[model samples]
Target chain A: MTAEPDLDRALVQHLADLARLHLPAERLATVLQNARRIVAAFGALGDLPLESGGDPDLQPVRLRTDTAEPPLPLDQVLANAPRTAGGMFVVPRVVDG
Target chain B: MTELWQLSAAGLADQVRRGSVSARDVVRASLDRIERVDPALHAFVDHRGERALADADAIDGARARGEPLGPLAGVPIGWKDNLVVAGERTSAGSRMLADYRSPFTATALQRLQAAGAVLLGRTNMDEFGMGSSTETSAHGPTRNPWHRDCVPGGSSGGSAAAVAAGLCPLAVGSDTGGSVRQPAALCGVFGLKPTYGRVSRYGLIAYASSLDCVGVLGRSVDDLALWLAATAGVDPADPTSVAAAPTTGAAAPAADLRGVRIGVPWQLNGPGLDDEVLATVQTALATLRELGAELVECSLPSVAHAVPTYYLLAMAEAASNLARYDGVRYGARRGEGTSCDAMTTASRSRGFGDEVQLRILLGTFALSVGYQDRYYGQAIRARELLRSDFARAFAACDLLVSPTSPVPAFPLGSRIDDPLAMYLCDALTVPASLAGLPALSQPCGYTAAGLPIGLQWTAPAFGEDRLLQVAGAFAAATDHHSRRPPA
Candidate 1:
């Protein structure tokens, strides 16, 4: 009741697709409702005068020299993958034959 | 209470180093304490007492062989689940990486272990550091040690609760918008979020790349100082880490804090603030004055807009940072042997909790082609305004002070279903996060119902030394930080 939110079924589907998440039909309504409410609440930031500038407090990222270093062992690299073969991660095939 | 577990981190380290106490016995005592108290608290998601005991024995053996002892030799500490320890499970309190063992330890954690800090276990947190109350943790929420019915303010709630309950003398947590300080306030302990770039972030499962910082929770300010000495420094592994030395403030806390200017932001006195919390912070300010601090009321008008701005930026960053967990290279997967897109969607949908998913969707929507200008772009401008407001406020005063949380810990589940209510809980603390300032929260006093209240002290970037000096002096002047919750 505090603020009107712009959440609709079509919008939820679009956002979910973009985010690469699947919201079940049953849970979609509640998720949409919550997202709408949070977006509206956070929309308060929009009220501030819009002037563009960089955050001066942000520190310059110090990049180290791009030196070749020993990489992690293959066994350790594939230790936690759900599926791996031929010393590589095996994902579902993407391209048609 | 166990005798060995009752000692501070420094005290235990000294005893162990001097051969007055064996590190094995200290670890055993802490393990016993955790077993006794953690059932009700549920603070730790991973209990590795056996591994901790073995690690402590290694320190004891090193000392036996006449090896030089590190500053934190044999002191046990807990890690928030987000920070990785090589060969250990790290989930960030999400189901996504529940079974994923780390490929390498975080540089901060590696540094601490090298300094002889023994790993106790990994603590719980809000899933991906999203929620204010830790209720969104896929692992159950951590309860406040003060009142079991109430929540520990989070996503660093578990670390704060563990330190408060004496399960460990020091626990490392992550702060993204009050995650560390808020919980420390609720749990009646010291929680310090050092300046951004103060600590390395090599393997800290990223919540918000620009905003996330490793923080420490402990019973004493000295413990935080000790932790920073061990972990804070430039790390080649983390490109954003600063080359700043751990600040060495005054030799000891001065008897009084003369010539210090603490600014009180006028914007914090608005509605939705609890009167009792305000009164507690006011009383703490009076104590600071008695110690010779001069209070100056200042203005940070843009701070009123900090919560929204902080969340917006954090969400956008999280969306980008978390895009890596699409059931490809690592982490648990679902919808096996399906199309790449379908498998990724299925895994993410179930792996992430509701709050996390909501943030992703909202962030994606904000960053979408048509809406990016209105939401994502505006938040960046608001952040600049907030930071400039801080710049102006700090120009007028040496430090900024406020209630770490607007209210004391509330009954669990009270605001779980209310997203705005949860977000508003962090209203007072997010401004510092947005500005990337160093801040600390310590127990100022307790409410009528005996719930703890936290008073916060914030400094401009790299002001950790002075901030800690004043906070440590105030802590020495008062007994608020020493009060313990009833067992």
Candidate 2:
């Protein structure tokens, strides 16, 4: 082994929290192992002689005209919503006050 | 008589347009073939027989009315589950969106349908195109048509399997990394990942947006050429789509590769390749030499950094893309009596498979506090190196060749539990993906045990015409492509 991962359980939990995942304790163990291995494998990139230039963004971002086109109909947009009320998505209350 | 389902897309379309075979007959034959073969392979998620038949009948009616027929007239094909078909469920092989119906169709599919192609069904894939093998599909794994126990590579495994098993003449799959080409190699078919932005990704479910490409898998280069010709062009709806004229269907392969320079990358073929696979590819290279193409040795040393760069960028994008799968608008939901954040978390926990979750977590870490530059940023820099490496190599060679997958199809369950091992399967494929170049995989030869080995050919961006021409030539000179798998 090159080196044991510098990761620990709290960091794993923190990552899950950031990603909005609630993986179970047992699954976390496996994620811990897999995540560490993947990240470690990422260490291989350091071996390359890389030159950073020109924003490193290969995709060209094209902007359309300023005029707005009609959006998807509200009903069509809400077609897949599990819960809807008054032509809008229904979700748990965000603020108690 | 050749079976209707067994004909190439171009061949079948020609016959249909000539009125010798009705579109309905082609659709029926494809559906019947799927019925006969899909049980063993699990290539499809939902059968759209009723809708497909209706579409086929429409095409026939148009023909009867003497209306101009489109290029893909009457050809039946499969779409990977990640692409949207209005009024059809696009699960992306995940339970999260199992009940979701697309409000609008993808632009690429719209183009294909306008060209008179009948959509037979939505094919299976890894849940959200995460896994290299189809085993991560919430539905089931798609078995290789060549061998039942072996895998059809993923996340486009089902599309590849359907084409290989003669269920459809052509299918559309997304290649984020080697999803399309790897499965194509394993299943013994032609798979093409066109240059980035060559095909619109408007309706393809995002999986690592930068790297994901809407690819095609078919039985022949002509079929792939036909499909690409129909679907490739600028889409105003997709901002990233480039303005390129649609390519014509492939001409017949040339008599010899007089001016073609084929590069054999030392980085692509080296240690860890199966002995049989290496031998089969070497034999294919010898065949190329006989066709008058000069073989040159080239090195893309940065290719060694491809896997890590691809994963880091793909995972970060996946994390951002999949963030839309909250319980609010669509997909599976949970946690009824809790706050929105809690409910969303619970729903995602219940929805995403292990592999997807792990990637998201890893991606989150890479982009997290203080680590973004070390992981995600470094990966981008490495990607630039790979892109330039290809540029330097192409300056000398007309095209490059390698085995699509280091080995043929592995056993279905062999690497499912080992994500790293599964990631390594794309060792030869991801480099082209990272560079945004056009690449195609076609059946070149077979291993001793009868598994197929694929010959991968890649050309510079927007070089699909030349790529198809070279592959078509190689296929014409050798009969390896004509050897069909026993479904």
Candidate 3:
């Protein structure tokens, strides 16, 4: 009965930040406008009632059977690390603990 | 040498089998062609010239010893960068994996190699196969061979362009949405996306798991069929791989479409399609009707929702699949940063292109707990409706035909700023992909400006054999598929 929702610039920027996208500041307005347009275009789905039935299409996430295969050598696994110390991939500590 | 490069895969194989042309000669000609044209096209991302020659020479030696070789023996084919080849860098046209090499070869590539096909090189593609055109590729765009200033469609643009420019007679590509068909149409070649699960997906870099299909680009339907026969089959390694008999034998040469029922959906008859493209498809339909097929006008109202459904589903799947690229276990790693989380964030920020990042964000949002039912769940329901629409249509008709793309290849940067317009280009092709049906794009005609237009034929799941038969019949009746762009 009502018009579908739209995405705003703030929302687009939030998504971009979450995705770690480096969109140029100059292009944000245009990207946001286009994103809004696309979301609006897809709003037709809101008119349909999709809640009547059980989720027949729901698929279970089948985890692969765990096997005790030999692990890769620590050196080989860390070979491509940008920085390493004491045979471990080193990174800046975030948590105080 | 020129003639050899222009020969269809079947023609080349026949000649080599009869000893009229040596395997070495064909490989040499292909390598020479790549050397001559690829510098400008940039179709190939990596070259294994010496290795390809060695493979060809070994095939020739086997032939001399009176040993039989595979059907496509010694023919050169380019692999799209997303398919892993053991010991070769599988970059997916991204700097994130620029130095990363796969320890395993794609099952499809391995099968092609066992069939004696020479690996020409890896071709360019969109970064993570995200964009409609190759402009989003970190390595740069692959130009349309028809008009260098125009674009070859993506994310299989490089493979399509290479086949069009005579860099290779055939190439392997992956289609999600319209990646294979759109590019092949833009470049004026034959591309086929077999029914989902027909080809193994093992070792292919996943973009959208359910939507991705490995496809083939070739100069002719016969060439495509040859590649399909070699690569399509069940693989225990890929659970989605179907356990069905191969369908290559159904591609018998047929001259008429008698008794075939063709459905033309009305939603595909909209204003976004170019006038010339519509005319070309209408003419093809008229010709098919004249040849004795019944043309049924059908309404697929649900098709209007196909593009959005595809995007939401694909982006959600892509977000989940690409979460593995967090700069820790594999691929490009950023220097030590404040924390593991910070390092991954910065690494992905600098690594993925704008389009890839955008989809990842959109997908993550769609799958977020509170929004899941509102977005991702609704999209899935829409996809089911689309599938049911196609299934109902197929019950009344044997095949469905539509224009491969709404418009012919637009200027390279025309829609770069307008993502909606760009996404609309795949409107017609997405319905078939959503339904997991097989589809083929064969050159139908040229635009008034001389760019190529494609006529797409789609069939139900496991209907590739029938689709190929119809396409082969159509190609035989017309010369459009044989017309090459003047390089």
Q: Which of 1 and 2 is the better model by lDDT?
A: 2
Q: Who wins the DockQ comparison?
A: 2
What share of the reference contacts survives in each candidate?
A: 0.70, 0.70, 0.34
True-vs-predicted CA distance for residue B425, candidate 1, Å: 1.0
Candidate 1 vs 3: which has more DockQ:
1
lDDT of 2 by residue, B1-487 (tens): 7888789999999999999999999999999988888888899997898889999999999999999888889999899999998888899999899899999899889999989899889999999999877999999898998998999998899999999889999999999898999999999999999999999999999988788899999999999988888888888888778887667666566778978999999988766899999999989999999999999999998887888989998999899899999989999999978999999999999999999999998888878877786778778888887888999999999999999999888897999999999999999999999888899999999988888899999999898998899999999898887888884
lDDT of model 2, residue B312: 91
- TM-score versus the correct structure, for each prediction: 0.96, 0.97, 0.94
TM-score of chain A of each: 0.75, 0.77, 0.65
lDDT string for model 1 (B170-278, tens) is 9999998999999999999999998999899899999888889999999988888888778888888887889886677222565688999999897875457799998
Rank ordering of all candidates by DockQ, starting from the highest: 2, 1, 3
Runs in model 2 lying further than 4 Å from the true structure: A1-5, A49-67
DockQ for each model: 0.57, 0.64, 0.40
Question: Cα lDDT of model 1 overall?
Answer: 0.87
DockQ of 3: 0.40
TM-score winner among the candidates?
2
Model 1 chain B is weakest, by summed lDDT over 10 consecutive residues, at: B245-254
User: Which of candidates 1 and 3 is the stronger one according to TM-score?
Assistant: 1
